[model samples]
Target: MRVLAAMSGGVDSAVAAARAVEAGHDVVGVHLALSRAGGTLRAGSRGCCTIEDALDARRAADRLGIPFYVWDFSERFREDVIADFVAEYQAGRTPNPCMRCNEKIKFAALLERALELGFDAVCTGHYALLVDGPDGRELHRASDAAKDQSYVLGVLTAEQLAHTYFPLGDTPSKALVRAEAAERGLTVAQKPDSHDICFIPDGDTRGWLADKVGAERGQILDRAGDVIGTHEGAHAFTVGQRRGLSIGTPAADGKPRFVLEVRPVSNTVVVGPKEALATAEISGIRATWTGAPPAAEEFDCHVQIRAHSDPVSARAQWRSGGVTVVPDAPFDGVAPGQTAVLYLGTRVLGQFTVDATVSAVAVDA
Candidate 1:
């Protein structure tokens, strides 16, 4: 089997490429350059697509004696992931750039190019499993639950899954991969994991957007619509954010208030008690399924709203191009533009972008 490994200059991907070689498959290493041009390394972190990372990937390929190359997809990445991220935020929604990268670049563009180049499959170091089910190829969470990345990959189509491989899915811990790299004398064995979003390395997403859109002064209002403070911009805030709000006045109950909503058009940040954050249902657009769409109109399943969050029990109902999910219990901080992944046991049922959620009803006296 011929495999094209997407090496991100990290220990996980390095080990993945090595595993492919050891499995007796012809392998080629490719590092995706997602940045426009060479930029200074962000403080305290070496993000992906850096010159150092490219060198590290080359060294790993040399150690494994495999063909290696760096593919510049910076333009496509900017259009699909980074630009989309900025646009969504400007519209007062939180977007997950990692998920966009996987859906657009890795699985769509890169996979298509790999097939055109005659590779049988494209491999990655994602901590998720691909298994052949009775229906077709199914994606599952990785062995390491804490590191499972299936949520971000929920947008993958069935065809993409058929030609993709996750070599590190069953690996119990990342520690094991580091140990293997040490044994193999790989250079990335001790490299710390990439932490910040590749494009926004300083972790100042607001700063990045402010530079792009120009900060606008806005009013910070309490739940009752009374102006409590002032903010630089509504885009700088997200639903349920508490810190950096600088609201001097306390809530009626003397508790710190949390941001409840960000209205872009109104340029307002609404604050309220934490209990106001609890929501019962969510609606989303752009829903996608792995295989055939479910036949049932509504069914019970587990739903995850954010990466690293435990799946919550919920009932899902599919609409025309969206889905409505009602969690068994109220969910807090269900933000718009976030992915809502549905799971049926270990398999990913489908996913959608959260548009809105149903407000909890008040009890009658």
Candidate 2:
């Protein structure tokens, strides 16, 4: 089998590409240049896809003795990942840029190109397993729970899953991957893993959004719709945010308040008690399955809302335009635009983009 290994200039990807070579697959390495800012350097692993990262990827490809190339996907990335992120925030929804990148750039765009070039699969270092189930390929959690990335990858469709390869999914720990990289003489063995949004390397998300969306003075309101304070912009806040809210009026009970909602259309930020963040139900659109769609319209599964959040036992139903999930217990701080990944034990059933949430406390009342 011919494999296209995505070398990200990181230890995990370097090892993943090397493993693909060791497995006797005809492998070719490619580094994706997601940004045109070639002079930009990674800020101690806060961001990725910088020029230095591309160079590192080239070096790893050299060590592995594979044909290497850097593909310029900057325009596509800006349109799909970065632009979508800003637009989602501007519309008062918290979006995961990494999820968008995986869905739009890596799996969709890169896989399309790889297939056109006759590669059997596009391999990466993602910490998620691909298992051949009765129906077809199924996505599963990585063996290392701490490093499981299946939640972010839940957006993958059945077709995408069929052409994806993860070499590090079965690895026991990240330490072992680093050790393997050192043994393979990969220079990125001691490199720190990138975190936060890659485009905003400084880790100042609020500042970054403000620049993109253009912050304006907005009213901060309570559940009763009465103004409690003022904010620089609605885009700077998201549901369940606790700190940095400059509210002049304290709650009646004198407890701290949390951001319950961001209404971009109204240019208002709603603040309330923490309990208001407990969501009982979630409704999502843009559903995608890892393999076959569920056989039943209604079934039991585990729903995970965030990359690191624990999955909650839930009942899911396929509705007219989307899916609805009712967790056995309330999920704290679920927000619209978040991805809800359904699971049956370790197997990922599918994912949906959350469009609405019903508060558990409100429902109970």
Candidate 3:
């Protein structure tokens, strides 16, 4: 089988590419150039696709004795991931760009391009499994729970899963992946993981957004609608954010308040007690199923609200062009725009982009 190994100039992808070569597949390494600016360097090890990174990927390809090319996916990435990110926040939703990248760029555009080039699959270093199940290809959690990336990859459709390859899914740990790179004579074995967004290497999301969209002065309001303080911008605050509220109106209990809502219309930020963030039900938009969409309208399953969040037992129902999730108990911080990945045991049933959440108060009402 011919495979396009996405070498991200990191330990994981370097090892994954090596593993593909060891598997006797005709593999070629390609590092994606995601950023538009060529001169700007990545701040520390927090960014991806920088010139240094491309060099690192090239070195890995040389060590493996495989041909490598730097593919420019910058325009597509900007339009799909970065632009959509700003728009989502502007609309008062906390969007996950990584999820968007996986959904739109990697699995969709990259996979399509790979197939056009006659590659059987596009391989990545994502910590998730692709199981050749009794029915067909199925996505599952990685063997190493600590590095499981199934949550973000929930957006993958059945077709994408069929052409996707995660070679590091069965690895015991990230430590072992680095070790494998060392044994394979790869130099990225000691490189740090890129923790920040590829575009914003410093991780200053607020500063980045402020530069794109002017930071509008907004009112910070309490539940009663009384203005307790002021904020830099509604886009700067996300649901469940605790710090930077700067509310001068001290809470009666002296406890810190959390962000409850970001009203884009009136440019207001709502703050309340943490208890207000406890939600009982979450509903999602644009649902995509991996195996089969559930037969029953409502069924028992586990729904993960965030990428790093724990999967909570919930009751899911297909309705109103979305999937409504009713947790077995109250769960906190079910924010809009986060993908709700559905799971049954180890198999990923499907995923939904969280559009709305019913708070515990709303549930009781």
TM-score of each: 0.97, 0.98, 0.97
Question: Which runs of model 1 end up more than 4 angstroms from their true locations?
Answer: 361-365
Q: Please give the lDDT score at residue 191 for candidate 2.
A: 96
Could you tell me which 10 consecutive residues in candidate 2 have the lowest summed lDDT? 356-365
**In model 1, what are the clashing residue pairs, if there are any?**
none
Q: Give candidate 1's error at residue 199 in angstroms.
A: 0.4
RMSD of each: 1.7, 1.2, 1.5
Say which candidate scores most in TM-score: 2
Off by over 4 Å in 3: 362-365
Per-residue error (Å), model 2, residue 11: 0.7
Best by lDDT: 2
How high is the lDDT of residue 46 in model 1? 41
